[model samples]
Target: MPTGTISKRSVDAANPESKDWLLWDDDLPGFGLKVTPAGGKVYVFQYRLARPGQAERTPARRYTIGKHGKLTPDQARKRAKDLAALVAQGIDPRQQEIDAIAAEDEAARVAAEQARLEGELAFENVAATWLDHYENEKGRRPSSVRQAKLVVNNHLKPRLQGKPMPHISRSDLQPVIDAIPAKQRGMRRSVFAYASILFGWAHKRGDIPDNPLASMVKPQAPKARDRVLDDAELVFVWQASAKLTDPFGPFFRLLILTGQRRSEVAAINWAELDRSTATWTIPADRAKNDVAHIVPLSKPVIAELDQLALAEQIKAEEEKPDGKRWPKSGFALTTTGRTPISGITKAKNALDAAISEAREKQPLPAWRIHDLRRTLATGFQRMGVRFEVTEAVLNHVSGAKSGVAGIYQRHDWHDEKRAALESWAAHIEAIVSKKQKDSKVVPIRAAL
Candidate 1:
């Protein structure tokens, strides 16, 4: 007899002292609720497979039934009946009960938090709020971001991203900074520096407590790429452009004429072009500084697009079943009318192949395709193009202005830029035959 449960006889006796006579007054030796000597009522369960006179029971388990306050008497009895059925089924009723409780706990834990969908929301509510506000919002997985993340996730985040974002300081970043190659380290530093800023941004919004980047040191930039492409290398790129068919041919030519980034040219959409005006409008979203840019399309740029338009119209007429008659590189890059090339990968393949083509012919100084822009600038400088005028042509923000004046002078610079680019385009056209030469299969050495 225990102190809690009152027997029916005790109720009939109308005496509280009779509670000691209750059947469930003590911890239940088998299953269901019980009462303790101190009068605390609790659910209890005990299970065995054999009677003492029978064969010894296999190992049995015990588990809680439920607190008396939590489970009504009738409810506890029903649970006890269920346990008895399990015991009849040759199951250790107590072990099943314990297993059930463990399973419930595990389910609750899983439901409490689900795995995060990383690509969702672009930036917020998903990616650990790790990058930028807008990028997380609008950007997709591109080469640049992919490359940058690989470094941070591999080298930095395992060490720092989970720490209090504000607690990341210069000392924490110093190890990665010092280990990077002397020439390639600036970008690595920029990644963490940007990360620190992002974490700080989160902190300011009360998402975090401190900015580790506040005291973080920026890694010094490695050697600058100052090498200018020589005239022979320049001519070789153009000549290679001539030998290549459709899109690659025209793309390299456009790159040489406009001196814009390859990605800028590759992703060009028809909406961005004003053919009549011989100009292209680059939306702020696409530009590095997020400023709108207007490029005055040179004759070569327009002429090249004109060829694409013709091919596109003709291809539309000749219509194939696959899909839209995509240009060589869709948007800005086009090969014929039917197929559109996409992504940095495809566009880069074109450039790399073209570079290999050029190398075979002339074997000029080693250089990357991006050097074309600097080469054009340097060529223009040599051609007596004014530095500021060339910079304007390049749509670069001038260093002289400060603050709101910069906002006021967003520096479209189209008019002067047009003239400057035309001058350089004329210089390039003289050497590379975008018009004079056509794609003829000639041996690289023989052509050279």
Candidate 2:
């Protein structure tokens, strides 16, 4: 061993021999530089655990400070002094370094696990997975899927977008249910149901440790809607619908004339309409009851559809200069011929504004597009149409057709359905024309 104050000059003058040699620092005991025959130079610190008032000496332990070029002699000395202080306090510096490395590794592992949980259990990510399973795996109807997505995006996602699934408690979601307006009781109930289903699914799949809303009381189901538009309101809505642009204008009128669901009517393809048969056939896949429905095209219904077709044709002709040609067949009512008209809510808002403007003194009550179907059903009842005929016309599987009767009575009621719908159309014409009340059923073709 060669002893000296470890300085830059002494370190530079030191040479490697046939064997490894150490130059111990004169200023700091146990701090030295080791030069290997392989031309490697390293700074090292040797220390023994302090045993206060003991006759025996603990075994010496050595700790590698760092490579010489990587750390100057002064920098290595500062670290060696730190180790010496720990050794004087009866701490083994080498064991302390080993323990520190172990703690750092444990901390890194825990952080990585936390990151993985965040990525996998985030509310948005889990909700997306659940929705995909709900729609594709569970085979839910398109309308039901759309409704679920609407509630999640519009109500839930805004509140819990990036939150971890397990960290979410009932407190985080209760406000979401409570925030829905009283007027939208159905929506409130739907939000609660959707949240419960999502959390329940996560818990079942082990994506979440526990369901946050497991103990929360579900919102009460909304009362069945019996809202039927009166004759005056019906007339007001019909007249206001005229103020809207293409697609929506005819879309609203067709919804009223045919008494079909909004989605069913909006998604009507030109192929679904048969002019020769004078019927719009809703395929089983599109129909809510999973049974095909034939809606008789009364003269008024045909008239509205014809006007839509002609308007689409005229617009296509106008677009000919722009290299656009009319599609041979597509959606019956669509702004673009490629797809059915969407943004129905936006269109309805515009229609309501028109209605409000038309009747400035008396505001029409809040009503949904679904209310139109109910209104038409009520109208059929008042027209003396048979219950079975009305059920067939509306394609409802309940009432006269449900259970034993539905199993037994397989009547298509084609002619009776036509007569009922025509009568309903005639009644609508009467209301719109202000010609007569619904008491006398006028022939729709004569009225047209």
Candidate 3:
């Protein structure tokens, strides 16, 4: 052992010997530099715990401050003075270091647990998981899945995002239900239904302690829509749709001509149509009822399709790079060739505006795009078409063709459906062209 001032020159000059040796600082009693036979030099502080006026002393414990190159001689001396102060105050510096490390580890564990709870219990995350289960596990229809997603993204997520699932209550959700327009009662009911389903699923999966929507009063189902566009309103819509932009104009016209659902009409592939047979085949996978349907293309429908095809070809020609040919097949009603037309709500709003402008009178009563199918069914019935044939045209498996009757009745009513659609198209043409005198009654034979 060497007793001297621990200076930078002295620490640098120290060398390892056959055995470890200590060089004690003159000013600090227990602080020193220890050099090992392996040529390792480290700053150290050795201390024994003792209280004032006590005779008993604890065994000596050495604290390694740092290596020689890592900590300068002056830096090691300052740290040793801190340890000496703790010893005079009857505190054990080594135990304090152990407590600090343990506290840091405990703090890290708590923070990680809080983060896990946040990620697992957030409303957005729970809803995403519920939707995946709803679509895949429950095997819901694509349209149903789409409607649920729309309600979540447009109505629910904006209001409840990031909220803890366990903390959500009915009070947090009532305002979301109240925000929808009063006139949109059906939409309000749909929002409530989707939210209920999501929370219910989360509760069942133990992701939530309880369903927040359980006590909330669900909105009553809206009354069935009986809205049918009158002849003048129908003609107004037809003429107005023509004045609007591409795809939408033709898309709306196809809905009227075919009496098909908006989604089915919008997703029409070019390959689904046969020019020679003048028929459009909606495959089972795409049909809402999961039944393959063959719709006869009336002259007007075929003509409208031809115009759409020509417009698409023109667009392709304009957009294609020089010497590159555009692919001829994709969705029939699409802006991008890869996907079907979307934003129908915006397009419908535009159509409503056009219809309002065209009418210039009492604004047409609130009607959904789905009302077009009802109107077509009503038209077929008024024209004396058989009930079964009308159902076949709309591809409905209810009424005449449901249950045991559906299982046994193999007749597709192909001819009757074709005639009914052709007559309806002619009726629409007559209304649009201003050639028909009375819209109330048309010859029954025309439908048969």
Candidate 4:
């Protein structure tokens, strides 16, 4: 190796036939210019890097600056001096360049990861995952799952769908929570509870840093419902119900006669009925309490089931253009008979209209289908039916047989429940017909 001040003229004048020789600068020990056999001249720096915690020197590393013409001798000398200063301070310039390139690549990776997360963990995406878990994984009933999706899609998603997960705050949710009517306390509570659960789920999964609902207070607690239809209202409902068309009309009558949940009554399957024994078995999955309940069908309930069965038979006989005939779904209250009845809103609206027209009175008090269940229970209690027997008739699992007693006591009160339901059904018939004298027993098979 030769040592001298590296200039353009000196580099160009050097032997073209020389086999890749390096000329080091006399002013700067490690700074040099490499001249190849093809006469290409480039400024370069060579230095031996010291091993950590040792006096031993490793092999020298060569770093290219630029071509001879790109940087003059003065500019090359200045750049080389700066690099030499870095070497004196125990820093490897070559390693520093490699680390800088790696830093740029790491920064790009982080930016890309952030962009992906922004799209994937938005409020709508999290809500979709939550809904899948509720219906598919947790095995919730279809009706309940439908309601949950309604709240999320109609209310939650419209407001928060595109918002970033971390950017969501309690303020973002408070207005939505406040918008739900206080009179519908139970629904408000449920909607808020579902929203809180969604945020909590995202937080637990590391999708969001914190739950916005955690800091926000929940909607007001629901008041206990005690509304039961009086005799006048009961008569009004019964008469109006008869004027209703098939399926919806019969469905409402069953709601009153059976004293079961509206969903349970509306979604009843024909296969659940046993005509000879006059009994309808509600499966565990369909029951609100998740317990398989046996409902002893009275003559009225039996007659209603028979009416639905007869209609289905008639519909099945009706021929289509293809001559395939109408299909029969296992559900009792469906229009198409291929799926369960889904026009609850339309049915209720029609019932309300009929009731108002029949009464000609100052706007009837607002009531839901569930009020019929309460009405039946209250009526049974007034008729001197024992509390336990009435509870069993309603298939309620609480009261005397709740908690440890419920766990230990296995008696189902089958006989008592049957007698109570039969008695209640007979009483409802007498009221609907506006007949007096409890002594006169009303057969449940009478026309509605």
TM-scores for all candidates: the values are 0.59, 0.70, 0.68, 0.80
Question: Which tens-of-lDDT digit does each residue in 264-310 have in candidate 3?
Answer: 99889987888778889998878988889999999999888787776
lDDT of each: 0.61, 0.85, 0.86, 0.80
lDDT of 4 by residue, 1-448 (tens): 7887777677767675558888888888888988888888889988887788889988988888888888988898888988888888889999899999999999999898677567786778778988898888554677778878988987788888788777788888887777777787877888788888788888998988889888888778888789999878888888888887888888888998889998898889877777777778998888888888999988888777777776766665743323122223388888876777878888888888998988775446999889999998888767776777777778888997688988998888777677777777778788787676555654322311
Better of 1 and 3 by lDDT: 3
RMSDs, each prediction?
13.3, 6.6, 7.3, 6.1
For residue 56, model 2's alpha carbon misses the true position, in angstroms, by 24
In candidate 3, stretches whose alpha carbon ends up further than 4 angstroms from where it belongs are 1-113, 131-146, 179-183, 209-216, 315-328, 360-362, 438-448
Q: To one decimal, what is the Cα RMSD in angstroms of model 2 from the true structure?
A: 6.6
- Residue-level lDDT for 11 in candidate 4: 70
Task: Identify the leading candidate in terms of lDDT.
Answer: 3
Candidate that beats the other on lDDT, 3 or 4, i.e. the better one: 3
TM-score, model 4 to reference:
0.80
Look at candidate 4 and give me any clashing residue pairs: none
Stretches of model 2 off by over 4 angstroms after superposition: 1-109, 132-142, 318-328, 442-448
Better of 1 and 2 by lDDT: 2
